[model samples]
Target: MAHRHDDLAGHDPDADWSLPGWLYTDPEFFEVECARIIRPSWQIVCHESDVAAPGAWRTLAYLGENIVVLRGEDGVVRAFHNVCRHRAMRLVDGDSGCARKLVCPYHAWAYELDGRLTGVPMRRDYPALALEDNGLVPVEVEIWRGFVFVRLEDDGGPSVARMMAPYDHEIAPYRFEDMRRLSDVRCRERQVNWKNVGDNYSDNLHIPVAHDGLTRLFGKSYAIEAAGWVDRMSGQLVDRASDDPWERFYQRHLPPVPHLPAENQRLWLYYKLWPNMAFDIYADQIDFMQWLPLSPTTCLLREMTFALPDERREMKLVRYANWRINRTVNAEDTWLIERVQQGMASSSYAAGPIGRSEVCLRSFAAKVRDRIPEARLHRAPPPGWSRRVRAI
Candidate 1:
């Protein structure tokens, strides 16, 4: 990929913005991201309520590694590398379940809820091996406001609280702990790059253009501002903005949502932590999505949860309506991002400059560049070199 900071030279607001095309399409670069970026980041595994009882377990895959998070007999949640100590076979096959002990199907290597090796098939065969030392390797697990997060790396950075510092005040009032997981939808085998999807969510500039249905119903002309790990994008609902038959019909049926200050109404809040996690908070509910890159071009998007426990049935219905609106918006984004994937493969493309209005996107790209030192070098090793060889 070419490095030309001068591309945005005349565009003062976007002067320093540059994202190499290879970062989105190169398999080598994607591997590096999995190691340096994804592995060390705090990933949401499951909600605490999901594993409320002892022996309850949830299985997940992160950066090519299978993980199992379970509530132990002691009633504390713990995470383990989902592989068995016996023959390196996977211990948990299903997404989630409750079990007295996690038993590997291949060899029946049973482990206690705390990941202690309990029953190894034909235990007499390994007289020299110590069961205590050969138990399932534990991963770092933490719970914040009912959300369970797991860190794979031994030297992972700050806690989830520190990482979410920017939106602490805004999210506190939501009383996330009181909310329950109502529904979840996982879209697997996505054919677009994970970063492309994340980039689309980070900026709401396309909402007015790509999401006509949304903008038409809930006015546009929104403002987008970035503050560390969070970004605020808000618009106003034009009073009696439309008299179209369809708009008027729905307006008469639906109760009015309390309007914010003209400047604050019709807001779309998109909060992202580095690597691949997004927590989008709307007025009625929250949408938590994570981008799991399976390869350079294929990714898995999991709409982990949508909770609105406190809202009335009518309000919940409205929240569901808003969720559908978001679904429409996401479908529009996926259409364009997939097209970009095809365009990225062309030799004619090299790089692109961020738009002045895309301040959040520019900030995201800057963070990516900052964490990815390889972006500074003309030729560098693949992204996962550190993980593959255990040397940076």
Candidate 2:
């Protein structure tokens, strides 16, 4: 591919065309993205609190690669490609656990929490095998605030902290490290391109028309702001309470989160991190979502919610109400994006102009172009293009 920003400079934001529809449904393009974009990007693995103690470990699959993040005996959190050195077999199976040593189920090769190959089942048979040279390969790991992120590629871009520095103060008040995850990671499969899901998340223009419940709650105050590679969409809850019994009851009875300011008590904030992560903050809770692509036209919306533990009866009820409300919002988003995906597959549909509120979408698409230059094509790439660009 051409150098970064080479193909993207020609894009005129005010009068530019959206990405060609076929890009959403092309297998070749998806393969390119897997190689050039997703593999090299930093992905949220889990909260720091998830692997809080030595021996605590978490496992996940990213872009078809299995990854393991664990807390070592020295109290350092480390990540590794979840492949046993002995036979290229999987090292970890489930989501998380607390284990002193990771024992490969295939051959019983045990590795220490720090990824050192401690025991080879048949030590005498392989006398030439050097223990010093054989160990689980490490993945780059970083912790920002409370979230843990791992870079799969050895030579990826800047650290997550540097990329996120601009919003440090804004995110500090949440004390993400102090908050605990409220549930297990929940995922829902949707029939839409991952980029389409990202485009939908970055778009504030559709809030009024597509998200009726949100419109009723926040009115027309939704606004989008950009800083570096991050975008924030914010709106204040309408002062006039809703007529719906659940909404009214929660607003009237549930107390605002004590740590947040009076103004923030009624704010809805969504921060879009480039590529595929979003942190959505509400008055009383925080939700992180990852748009993990399963194929060209399918994705898994992996989501998790977090908050300071509360024992109040009314607050529990309010949290349940909030959960119900988010379900409605997500359902609305699913319906809208799936329809858009269906339209993209149709022969009659073509690229459309973006509105002002969708400037973030344009910027995101530009980032995609920077990573995969051939995204402008309305059909599959030339036979050699993917291999050629991937070599770069």
Candidate 3:
């Protein structure tokens, strides 16, 4: 278990330690992570249903890329740079909408739904500009179980389907391909490194101590385990009544999801993928939480909720109750992570020992250090470290 960058690597292989605090606060460290870990990773962009028709499209602003995902006339979904091919003007505005053509607001340049340049304000003004050659620049795209995923820059690694194969059988029953969007992607900005949010998601030990509603619902049944690329957590709801009205109502009215097994009906499962994607699966709905880094100290959290079509009054009630309950959980996590960010930034702090049972957090930290070996340093490297040194 000796790592190439750290002299202390020879310590027991099972030893779990949190990443150094400098890694969280250093701007140089963030740049290294973006190049080594973020750029080449696959990102879940949108569900197919979000752009179900040829004219439907959605945009994602991540790291520094302005990407638009859309369905074409031939029924194929594609991704392209959101910039106009003419003069680099943004081709789309806002989060999502249906458009017959992607027209640039700056110069009136237009593109077909599939990104083929179709119209320019002055057609004969530039005869040298070839329409076919000047189509929008495409980004890599893959659809997994009807969910659209794109890589900002490809690194010839495994596809999302390949990486997710370990849990394919378990997730098959949910039939993500058949589910439809319950809401648009909700954006939440926070003053913390992206890893802080990710580390919080993989953390299980904090729940009983910090989330009162979750403690009342799941009690001591929560569990977490890690694989090389994903972490799984599950908790079965307690039969005992909860004092919280939302939790009680949810438990009482959670109608039998006929498609799921008996055990699954009462279970809440969460899966965190390598780098930045996480799925919160309930029998009633699936919620995705994806965190993307903006700077050394800021990140954006994008969330989307999906569910199978059901119009039953009880089912609707259950869905609303579920939102109310999880809203509390998310707020609790925000407070905890912001505090972690502030604490990690303090001169008094270095690194702390991770509790023995925090396996998921340990795995995530190990992966980070593995991806960017410099993350093993107790202090931030010299400025210009990213450009002056090669990590991998």
Candidate 4:
């Protein structure tokens, strides 16, 4: 059904919309978001322990940028653009590896683990070539609770630690720093806008209607709220049996985690940072993902799971059961997102109303409009609109 733009956006008390439909479908708006929102936002690359040893490295590719998170000889974790300064050739390939020095495969230019230029082949041929000033360009890095986060450009926003300070004390007992990686990093592509993924994750209104297993586990205890820069969500697993085999297995086999507080032993937490960093903290494991914008209507999902070492047989079974349960939730979400994306593309649809009490959705919309006011428009601004605004 068709809805008037102004009435949906302002006049009708029944309708409060998030980003307009065109915003999700516009290539120009996507470009602006990548430059204005994604570059400055912190992205989780890998856990610090992933690059624990000297010279260990992991590569992250996101929204046209490639990054390398390396541990230097001095045992410090640092991040830098993945391109060689000599010819912009990629130095490291694949997900992760160890190297004594970053040597370019193209020209044999070498850099120290700390990103200082060390060797260049045929040094005398280019007498004016200054190795001292040509190391890999650095990216800002932050390690919070064992996660390594990097941003292409410093936006002067709060560090990851400061941004999540509200929940630090409560989550401290989880001891994430001691957790070990449990699975290899995985990635997949989705044919929907990146914001669709975030919006679905933070929207608790869909749980009872969308995820029955989650409702079975958490009952009515699943809660959501917006906390400044983060959208916080959690559900306390009810101490009861489930008819679903997977959920039942988890409910029966999941043992008490001695390290976590009694209340958190069965709690599952979800936190979405300002842009697209999502932390899914569970009693069995913590799984984090970066929903990166790949194109106007497609996004990349990269994630890995981590947890404390537990060799017990049932604990292993519990983790597997948990995976299966969430796997279904993800598949269901994919179906829902594709339907919405298709519906929004229709000639008639303009925007959908977001309720006022929907704190997470409201918070997300406000943040987008705050950074990119063009998002407030009912349609995509004309070409050169940004320049016109700048001139004014």
Per-candidate TM-score against the hidden true structure = 0.84, 0.93, 0.93, 0.95
TM match of model 3 to true structure: 0.93
lDDT of 3 by residue, 49-161 (tens): 89999889888888788899999999999999999877799988888888989889999988998888989878898979888899999999999998999898877767888
Tens digit of lDDT per residue, candidate 4, span 175-224?
88998899899899999999988988888778889889999999888877
* Regions of model 4 farther than 4 Å from truth: 1-15
Candidate 2 local lDDT, 1-392, one digit each (tens) = 00111123354442266787878887888887877788888899899899999999988796889899999999899999999988899988889989889999998988998889989978889978888788999998989888899988844566778767777787777778898999999978889999999988978778878887777777777778656677788877776788766666656766767887777887888988878899998767899999988999999988899988888888788888888877888889888999999999988766777554466776777777667667765555567777786598
RMSD values for the candidates in order, in angstroms, are 5.3, 4.0, 3.9, 4.2
Task: Give the per-residue lDDT of model 1 (tens digit) for 1-392.
Answer: 01112121233333355566667778778877787778887888888888899999887786779999999999999999999887789887878889999889998888999988888768899888799998899999878878989988845467888767866776676667766777754756678888888777766667767877657766744556666555555544445644454444433334434532333334555677665788876655677888898898989988765564555666656665666666767878889889988887777766675666676676666666656755533234556654565553
- On TM-score, the leading prediction is 4
lDDT of each: 0.71, 0.81, 0.86, 0.86
Query: Model 4, residue 157: what's the lDDT?
Result: 76
How much is 352 displaced in model 2, in angstroms?
A: 1.7
**Candidate order (lDDT):** 3, 4, 2, 1
Error of 3 at 95 (Å): 1.2
